[model samples]
Target chain A: MEFLSERARQKLKSALLILSFFVLWEVACLVFKVSEIVLPRPTVILGALWQFFPGIRPHLIQTLYTTLVGFALGVGIGVVIGAVIGVSRVAYDTAYPLLVGFSSIPKVAVVPIFVLWFGAGTTPAILTSMVICIFPIVVNVATGLATTEPELEDVLKALGAKKLDILWNVSLPRAMPYFFASLKVAITLAFVGTVLSETVASNRGIGNLMMIASSNFNVPLVFAGLFLLAGLGVALYVIFSLIERRVAGWAMRKQDFAMG
Target chain B: MMAAKPDTFVPALPPSAPERARPLISLEGAGITYGRGANAVEALTPTDLDIDKGDFVALVGPSGCGKSTILKLVANLIRASRGHVFVGGREVGAERVGIGMAFQNPTMLPWLRIRDNIMLPLKIVEPFRSEFRAKRKTEFRDRAEALLEVVGLKGFGDKYPWQLSGGMLQRANLCRALIHDPALLLLDEPFGALDQFTREELWAILQQLWMDRKPTVILVTHDLREAAYLATRVCVMSARPGRIVADDAVPFARPRTLDMTFEPEFVALTQRLRGLIVDARTGKV
Candidate 1:
């Protein structure tokens, strides 16, 4: 107990909470005599996952690959468009309304269009995820750059720095925390976009497997598919969080005291 | 030794020539107005002022007297609606070089280490910028470290801006401003947010930096005591449509100490500056 640091203790508490949640869920399913089709118990879901892991592995890889490819493209395009809109008044005024309008349309609605244009497979899934995740990244990056303190700009401007110099030295670096935050949001959205396309069009990926599982009334397998997706999402989120801590730790430290 | 031909030699100009002794900075009836037409509000009145090289001048008055506006004009951060601003014998334009500025808020880039933040200008301002990459590890880093030491932030170069206290950040802010050895230094109430003890401590640090480097400084502050303590000349401005109403030269010797602030002459000088501001605020000046 003495050897456990505060972070380790906190992590242990989280693990215990998750373990208890599953135990409670398992007990309720048994006591209520709930039908497996209606609500499969945690143990049953785990069993199905262990039994079908080999078959599920390819679908899992498909979804992960689709989401990552889409997310990387989304981040690259988002940052460029965001930097443009953030720095230029003309871009902000002309493009912002259009972007907002486009984002407001349900991403699910756009999946069929993507499938129609690209034909049913990985292409539609990748395209859907790319489109879905770009909005948050663009909005966040633009806001970050637009909100750069005038004082900071003045510090460089007084030294006769050119516009590009200011953008490179100050605006982009200042916008890093905002960019990283959007990565967390966009990463999750990327998964949603991929799955949406996969369920609607693709014959591959976890979403398609879950679709097939539900159609055959394989409740345990469906739950297992969900568990895999959730696990993958959490893994990606954790990776992004670690990267954020490394690059934008200054803003993170400020936020801790700010909350207090 | 061969004797130099008299025809090849050019005689030196007389010292009395106006061009020979022109001020480092000259505002020829310069003024600024916000917006245009019906919505326009005059911030600074058309006024003339001259500052010689290495002069420490403080602009002091009530709030809204546009003291900071004057500094911005000098830095060429904003354009004058009337007349011209000349710095280093050239009219102010889109491109202004050899200027360093610090505000009340310590505007250090949070992502950068203190040393990197101080060396920022070197990566942008020319001559140094041209050779920055080559000398960054040796010459530039040593300069940043030296300034940090001067500001009492020795060995804190690797720390982020947030890790330091408000006072320490402000001290770092001063180090950043002085690191480039700019021809002009503009400070807009840089210690305005600090506690009294911290503010007084910083005053000594700033004075030492200024005395050593001798960059022409224009400090904009509401603190009359600060104006008297640090400046060679204190210019008091009238409130609204700000104009220089009073310009008084401090009769104090160099290497001024904090203890000297308590002297009768220093006290009287600050009191007179305070009185000018009060009158300006009351519309009696």
Candidate 2:
């Protein structure tokens, strides 16, 4: 304990808290003689997950591949569109209302239309995820660009920097922290979108597997699917957070001093 | 070590003969009025001015006197509502280039290291711009580092802008402004945000940079002493519908020291400029 740093101690405390929560849940289920169908214990879920690991592998890979492809496309399109709106008042004024209106429509409502257009498979799932994640990135990147310091712009403008030059040198770099922030939000939403589409229309994926498990009254297996999805979402979120720290470390440093 | 008392009133020197024939910058009845119709606010009154090459001119007055407006007009950051502005014998237009500018805020990009910040202008302005990437690691880096050393910021080039103090950032801002060696430099109260001691120290650093480069400078400031100390000519502007009411020549010699600021003649000159501003603010001009 004495050798542990403050960060290490905090992490240890968090792990202990999570472990205790599972222990309490397991104990309560046993003490109450709760039916496995009503609420599967964490141990039962873990056991089911281990037993079904070989069979679930393909579905897990399918979900991951769909999410990554959709997310990559979303980021590429979002950055370009965001840059356009950010740099031009006309684009922002014209596109902002439409974007707001579109994003407001619950993304789950859009999955059926994607299924109709692209058919019930990986295509619908990928399209759903791609559309779901784009809005946050666009809004964040636009806000970042629009907020560039007028003083900085004047400095470059006086040096005869063209509009393109200003965009490259100032606006894009300034928007990075915002872009990374959006990525964190977008990644989680991407998982939600993929799962929702897979449940509604796809034959393969964690969502479809969970649907089948629940229909069969295999409560532990259903819970296992949920845990798997949650684990994957957290892992992606943490990976994006790490990337954000590396790319926008200056902004993070500012935040650290601000919080202190 | 007291210098002899000098004449209290020295006539403004007409831009010497040949220089007068082709002044570097001339403003003829140029004015600016923001908005349109009834909502319009006249920011600057149409007026005339001429600055010769290598001259150091300061525009000083109360706030909203359009001293900063004049700098913007010359820099072509904003268009004039009336009349014309000529730079290098050509009418100022959209394509004006090769000018250096610094603001009171010390607007360094936080993401860029100090050396890169200083070299930013070179990556845009021509001659250097055409070859900036090729020389970025070698020639440009050396130029930025050399300027850092000159401003007493040696060995701090690798640090980010946020890591430096306010005064150090201002010094870097100055370095950025002078990095390209532009023929014209516009400073809009570049030291206005600093404390008294830091401000004084910057005045020396700025003066050294100005003396060494001798760029035609147009500095907008509220500090009358700063105007008197730095500029070869100090222009006092009227409040509101701003116009230059007086253009007085400073009689100080080149390479002026901080101690010179305490001399009776220097004090008298600042006092006279201060009076002009006070009178202008009260509409007594």
Candidate 3:
């Protein structure tokens, strides 16, 4: 530990911290004689994950596909609607409160409506994911455009710039950092929307796998499914994070030092 | 509106000569009142001014004197409630004519590289706008580099705005404002955010740019010395519901330097303007 560099030390510390939690979980489960039906040991969950890996592959793929489709649509529509709302005061005043009200309805509750409308399958899952994830993107993009410095707008206007020119040259670029931030949040929520709908209405995906495993008292398999979903969420988050770094690294320059 | 035109004997000049010789920008009894009647607040009183072609004018007054409002009026960013604002002898229209602007903050797009930020205007304003896509990359690069060189940022165009110091950013800001070779430039306390040393340095930079191009410039500032040093004419505005109370012509010669601020006449002029602003602030006219 003493020989380790500072960054290595930090990584080691984090690893040890996470490792200690699992160690405590395994020991507590065994020592307390906790019923395996209620909670399985970390090793048992790992064993189940390996054993069920082949069977869970299709479910994992289905979940990932649905989430990605929904997220893509959410981002596409969010950008257009957000830009329209942000650019026009009349549209903003009219749409903002309605959006706020609509987003307030729990997306989980809407899953049943989606099910009734589309039946229990990928359609409901995708729509639910889109519904849950689009709000943050709209909020962020609209805020970015709405807050464009009036002075900057004046500069462009004085140059004979049309509304479209300002949006392309100034507003949209200004929204990138906000847009990327929303992507990170939206991607995570995309998973939630997918899984919630899958649990309620879909016959496929990890959500359905976990539900079936739980009913069969296969606690370890359920934990395995949860871990798989977490892994997928983390992988998607990291991909977006990498994209964010490449596209908008300049914005994070000051934040990097502060975070360190 | 009823003020009579003087009857003078005359005419060696062409009939349209007098009209042609009229100032490039004029606000004739132009004013702005925000909101509707009853609750409306008059931000600017009916004001009259004329800025000749290539003249450098500075508007100096208190915080709410509507000095910046006058800049906006000239740029046609806002309409005058009472009368007309004429640019190039025509009434100001919704469509913008050639005008460039810079503010106290650099207002550089953080996402854009310094060079691209400077090139933004050309990509929008026409003649250049229509050809920007077809022009060789090197042509745009050369123009940006030339402007950057003038601002002492020759090799730094690839850097982001965040990477530059405050003074360097302001330099880029000035370059962006001038990149289009506009007929008129509007500056709203362009150096107000910098420290004294940097502010003085930028004054020299701006002075050089103005000298080289001779665009019609209207600077709005609280710093009387900045107004006195940079402008050929300094106009003082009264506090709220602002109206110009004094329009003093600066007598300093061209290529003025920092040393000139210490000269007796420069000191006297700045002090006089300062006193006028104080009186304006106190509602004493």
Model 3: CA > 4 A from native: A1-9, A255-260, B1-20, B94-96
Model 3: how far residue B158 lies from native, Å: 2.1
How many clashes does each candidate structure show, in the order listed? 0, 0, 0
Question: Where does the lowest 10-residue lDDT sum fall in candidate 2 chain B?
Answer: B1-10
Worst 10 residues of 3 chain B by lDDT: B1-10
Give all TM-scores, in the order shown.
Answer: 0.93, 0.92, 0.92
Q: Which regions of candidate 2 fall more than 4 Å away from where they truly are?
A: A1-4, A254-260, B1-19, B94-97
* Model 3, span B124-220: residue lDDT tens: 9887898898762778779989989988898999888877999999999999999889999999999998999999888988899999999999999
Can you give the lDDT of residue B82 in candidate 1? 94
Candidates, DockQ:
0.70, 0.75, 0.74
Q: Give native contacts recovered, as a fraction, per prediction.
A: 0.91, 0.83, 0.94
Reference contact recovery of candidate 3: 0.94
Looking only at chain B, model 1 earns a TM-score of 0.92
lDDT per residue as tens, model 3, A120-225: 9999999988987888999999998888898999999888888899888888877888899999999999999999999988789989999999999999999999
**lDDT for every model?**
0.89, 0.88, 0.88
